[model samples]
Target: MKRKTLREEIFYKGIGLHKGEDIKLRLIPAENGGIVFKRVDLEEGKNEILMDIENSFDLTRGTNLRNEFGASVYTIEHFLSALYIMNITDLIVELDGNELPILDGSAKIFVELLESVGTKNLKEDVEEIVIESPINLTVGDKHIVGLPFDGYKITYTIKFDHSFLKSQMLEVVVDLESYKNEIAKARTFGFDYEIEYLKNNNLALGGTLENAIVVKKDGVLNPDGLRYEDEFVRHKILDLIGDLKVLNRPIRGHIIAIKAGHALDIEFAKLLKK
Candidate 1:
C-alpha cells in the first residue's frame, strides 16, 4: 500500500468534551511526513507534535500528546482511529485549541468527513510493524499482548461492575470496511452516577446524551439506544486502534487486551516500540 493523505483540505468545528470550549481543526495534505499536529494557538516554531510514542501523554480521560516546547493536544484517539483505519499516513492537523472536538463522542463523524474528502496516494510505500515474537504486558489484572499475525486484528474484553454492563467482548480483523460497519458508530460511554463527580472535577463538561452513552443503573439514559448490543467493547477496540498509532506505522499483529484503558494502552505502545 502507498502512503495516503487527504485529497484536499477539510475543516471541522465542535465543542471540547473536557474543556467545553469551541475548537476548530483543519486537515491538510502532506507530501511525505507522517501525521503531525500543529497547535495553531501556540508559538509557530514550537507548536508541532509528531504522531509517535515519544510524544504520548497519559491522561485520565483521553489520549494526549505533548511536545518538548510544552504544546499539547488532548482527546485525539477518536480522530486518530479514523485516520489509521483509512490508511492515511501523511497529513498535518492544524488545531486552534488544546483539545479536539468530541464530535458525537465516536469516530463516525471523523470517518465520514475523511471519506467525503477521499484520499490521495503518495509515492512512498507503506511501512508496517510486524510482530516477530509475542509481547506480553500486564498491569495488575489488566493485560495486553501482541502476537504475530498476517493482518491487523484485535480481541478486547471489558468488564464493568454495573448491572447494565457486566462483561463485553469483541474480536475482529481490522479493515476499513469492518471498522465502519462494526465499530465506528460505537460511542464513548460513562456511568450516570459518575457524571456529577466528573463535572465537579471539570471533566466531561461538554458531554451529553447525544454525544455519549450514559449508562444508568437500570439502563441507558440516551433516548436512542446502543448501536450494537456490545457497543462498549467495540468502542474499546476503537480506542485501542487509535492508541496503537503511537507506533506511527501500520501494525500487522494481533492485539489482545483485557480491561485496558489509555494508560495501559500507552504503556503497551512503549513496550511495542522496544
Candidate 2:
C-alpha cells in the first residue's frame, strides 16, 4: 500500500489529563518519511521538538517524548495508534501544549477527525520492519514476545487481582476496518482504588467516569458501562499497537503480551530494534 497523510490540517482541543490545562493539536501532512511533532508554542529562541523512540521519557503514565530544549509532549499513544492503523507514513503534529487532549480517553475521536478531512496518498511505497527472529522479554510474571509474521498481529492478555476483572484476553490483526470498529473506541479504564491512589499522588487529575471505565469492588461505576464487554483487554491491545508504532515503520510481526504495561511495551520495542 502507498503511504498516506492528511489532505489538509485538522485541529483539536481538550483538557490535558495530567496538566489540567487547555491543549491544542494540529495535524498536518508531510512527505513520505516519519512522523514528527513540532511545538508551536516555543519562543523564537527555543528549538522545535520531535517525537521518536530514542527521545521517549516518562513511561510511568503515558508515552512521552522530550527534546533537549525542554519541550515535551505526553499521552500521544491514542493519536499515534490511529495513524498507525490507517497506515499513515509521514505527518507533522503541531501542538501548543505539553500534553495532547484526553479526548474521551480513546482513539475514536482522532480517527473520526482524520476521516473527516480525508487522506491523500503519496507516491511512495510503504516500508515495514520485518521481524527476523523471535524476541522475548520477561520481567517477573509479565512477558512480551514478538515473532515474525506476514502482517501485524497483536494478542494481549490482562490479569487483575480485582474480582470485577480477573483476566481478559484480546487479539487483533491490525487493519483499518478492525482498528476503527474494534480498537479505536475502547476507552482507558482504572479501578476505583487506583483512582483514589492517583489522586493521592497528584496524578490522573483529569480522569473521570466519563473518560474512563471506573470499576469498584462490586462492578463498574460508569453509568453507560463499557463500550465493549472485553474493553479492558481491548484497551491493552490498543496501547500495545500504539507503542509498536514507535518503530517508525509498519511492523510485520505477531506480538503476544501478558500483563504488560507502558514500561515493558517500550522495552519490547527497544529490544526489537537491537
Candidate 3:
C-alpha cells in the first residue's frame, strides 16, 4: 500500500520532561518519504534537523537526536510512536525547543489532538521494514527478540521485584486503528523512591499524579489506582513501541520482550537495522 502523510496542521505545547521548560510542537504534512524536525527558533544560518536512525544518540531515560551543529531533540518517543502507529510516512515536525512536550506523560493526548484535526492520505505506497531474520539481544535474564511476521505484533513481559508488579505479560497487535484505543492511554510510571532523585537530578520534572502512575513500595500512590490492572507492563510495552518507532518505519515482525527498558529497546532496534 502507498504511504500516508498528515493532511493538516496540528499543534501542541507543554513542559519538557528533563529541561522543565515550555516547548511547542507543530506537525505538518510532507510529500516525501522521510520525517524532518525543524528548529524554528534557531538563529539565522542554522538548518532544520531531519529525523533519522543515523542521528539517534544516547538512550538515557528517553530517546535523543543530535547533529554536529549541536542541535538536539530529546524524549521524542511518544510523538514518534503516534506518527508511526498512524502510518504517517512523511511529516515536518516543527518545534520551538530542544525537547517535545511531556503532555500527560503518555501518547494519549497527542493521539487525541491528531485525530481531532484528522489525517490526510497521500498518493504513495506505504513502505515497511519486514524482518528477514531473527534478531535478539539479551541482558542478564532480560531479553528482546524480533522475528519475521506478516504485520506488527509485540509481546512484552515485565518482571518487577515489587509485590504489586511482579511478573506481567502483555501482547499487543499494533495497527493504526487499535493504537489509540488500546495502547495510547497507558501512562508512564515511576517508583515512589525515584521521585526525589528525579527532581534533584532535573529529570521527570513535569511528572505528576495527573500525568503518570506512581507506585509506592507497598502499593500504588495514585488515589484512582491504575488505569489497567497490568498498567505497568502495558506502559513498558507502550514505551517499547515508541522506542522502536525510532527505526522510522513500520516494522512487520513479532517482538518478544522481557524486562526491557530504553537502553535494551534501542539495542534491539540497532540490531534490527543491521
Best-fitting candidate, scored by lDDT? 1
Per-residue CA lDDT of model 1 for 1-274, tens digit only, reads 8999999999999999988888998999999879899999999899999887788776578899999988998999999899889989999999999888999989999999999999999999987888889999998999999999999999999998888899998999999999999989999999988999998999888898889999998889999898999999999999999988767678999999999999999999888777
Per-model CA lDDT versus the true structure: 0.91, 0.84, 0.81
Candidate 3 residues lying further than 4 Å off, grouped into runs, are 44-47
TM-score of 3: 0.93
lDDT comparing candidate 2 with the true structure:
0.84
Clashes of 1: 0
In angstroms, give how far residue 68 of model 1 lies from its true place. 1.1
Clashing pairs in 2: none
Model 2 agreement with the true structure over 1-274: per-residue lDDT tens digits: 6888889999888877876678888888998556877788886445455657888888988888888878878888887888888777789888888788888989998889989988888998777787879889999999999899898889999998887888998888988888988899999888877877888887778787767788888889989888899998998888888887787678888999999988899998898767
lDDT of 2 at 49: 56
What TM-score would candidate 2 get against the native? 0.94
Give the CA lDDT, 0 to 100, for residue 60 in model 3: 66
Reference-based TM-score, model 1: 0.97
lDDT of 3 by residue, 1-274 (tens): 5667776888888888777788888888888847888888886446466777778788868887876687888888888778777777688888898889988878888877877877677787666778878888999988999988888899998888886668889888888666776788888888888899999988887777887788887788889887888877777877888888777777889999998888888888888777
Q: Please report the candidate that would top TM-score against the real structure.
A: 1
